[model samples]
Target: MSTPTSPGEGAPTDALGRALRLVSFAMLGGVVAIAAVAVFTVGDEAGSGVDAFGAILVSVVFVAAALFVPRRLVRPWPATAAPNEVKAAGQLRSAAFLSLVFAELPTLIGLVNSFARGVWLPVAIGALFSVAGLLLTAPTADRLREWLARMESAGARTGL
Candidate 1:
């Protein structure tokens, strides 16, 4: 009875943007708090242990936050795509989707690098991996927006 929608953009920007921002700050605070706790609790005496703790703790929180918010926000977030936009689950004939996958590359690299050094030597590897995983999913919503905008413009020019 209703139209199909884009995944993350369903929430209108002007309205949902504030809520989204609020949620974002809250989530960020949560991760930072996790890091702060890890740092303060794990001082120089046991620097590696605490560093490991902070990293893993923050990493897990990031992953959990990413997964949880989308589901929670799904209801209230209306699809904000313009009519010509490429909705989620639509055909992926182009390379637009690659942006999302690669967007978190920087963060992932840092995490992985930390992990590589830590793996055999046993450092904050858990946290590094956790952060890397979190980074992996970071770009979806933005990538969707970018892809849709590209699609719309291209379609407009081609009269698609």
Candidate 2:
């Protein structure tokens, strides 16, 4: 709930910004590592039968959830909360965690499929989704400020 800072105003030096960036990078790193392992171990032939079907089904579910869930989970700032950096930080942290978890889900599913069935497609698709999500939603200072500003504007319009 802190007053939204202008772009390039050095918000990253704040504690909340540092924590958000650290967590965002950690999640991205995990996805990259998993994807790399899966890619490096590719073998002959894709998976078949029930194993293949299950992998496909699970992958679909994970990808769908990844695409849809994070936005819903990142609720707006609470009205009763003090308007301060701590509140802003808490909101940013929550949003970042939700985004990262869903984004990483597909990659995890892909890794499992790759390890169990030796198929590369799922892993590759997962890597693409993971990287895209991480890049698009990574909680930098500017992004956080933008999101908070939007939420604040919405709250104002709704009379919250």
Candidate 3:
């Protein structure tokens, strides 16, 4: 027999999804704000060639790190630790925020370069990389469900 869920039963999950989306938008907003500030302060000025190749290379490395580091941080629970879905869910939330921070690095670097060299190219490159990272890492309801299911199975196995 199955139990009927209340109307507000899924509110937490829905709220989580909304919160993650909000965070994603906030990161994008940061990029926009940086761009606006750069434009207003620098005023269409082309900077004296601040090593375009180097900036692009650094951006690529940071983007790659942003994509890779989160998986390491979200590792499975150790055998000694009792499995708790609530804890797993909290870990997921923490990991998501950390991932966003890593993803935002490119944009922050671009902002620094923009301010130092007074060029827009660095900011644009950084924004592109960060946007891709942010979009790729944004958590969805389906992903949350899958993660919970996986964690439950792992708990079952360990609890046996």
Candidate 4:
């Protein structure tokens, strides 16, 4: 009888890609959950435009962070030797983790603003930004291949 292959028995890149996608989807779902919670609990305590200013500004900054921080995190891999799949996977995972965390920040901020000030606009704005960030940074198969190719090219360049 043939023994069944384990979940992680695939190539490192494949396994890592699957894990990243799962985490990304979970984070996106959390944004939806935040919206549901706010709808059910937050009251129509209409906030002044001035009161929403801070939440809007903070959410914008967090969304920008979600867009840029992950690229910086993965940019410093030591390509002095050769591109190692294991090391590349580690770096990708780190970048993806930060990407998801940063993306989720706006939703959390929105939830806080809703509970504290009862403004619903920030929740909607934040959820929109959060979803965009999550979708943009999601580790799909094409993205994974591109990243690996870039790492390989960098390694080749530095090896000379």
Q: Pick the candidate with the highest lDDT.
A: 4
Give the per-residue lDDT digits (tens) of candidate 4, residues 1-160: 0111355554446767888999899899989888777857687765677646766787778878877887666553445665455566777778778878988888788888777777776776678788888898788766665555555554442110
Predicted candidate 3 versus true structure: per-residue lDDT over 36-90, tens digit per residue: 6765675476554554665577778876776677666655445466646467657
- Tens-place lDDT digits, model 1, residues 1-160: 1222555545332232344335444443444444444434433333355445554555455455544444332221124543432333232222322322232232343244344444221123433443454444433445334433444443332111
Worst 10 residues of 1 by lDDT: 91-100
Best by TM-score: 4
Clashing pairs in 4: none
Over the full model, what C-alpha lDDT does candidate 1 score relative to the true structure?
0.37
Candidate with better TM-score, 1 vs 4: 4
Q: Rank the candidates by TM-score, best first.
A: 4, 3, 2, 1
TM-score of each: 0.32, 0.68, 0.75, 0.78
Which pairs clash in the backbone of model 2?
A: 1-88
TM-score of candidate 1 against the unseen true structure: 0.32
* Per-candidate local distance difference test: 0.37, 0.64, 0.65, 0.71
- How far residue 153's Cα lies from its native spot in candidate 1, in Å, is 3.0
Better of 1 and 4 by lDDT: 4
Model 2, range 76-104, lDDT digits (tens) per residue? 65455444555555665777677767767
Query: Which stretches of model 2 miss by more than 4 angstroms?
Result: 1-4, 7-9, 12-14, 46-68, 74-81, 154-160
- Which lDDT value does model 4 have at 26? 89
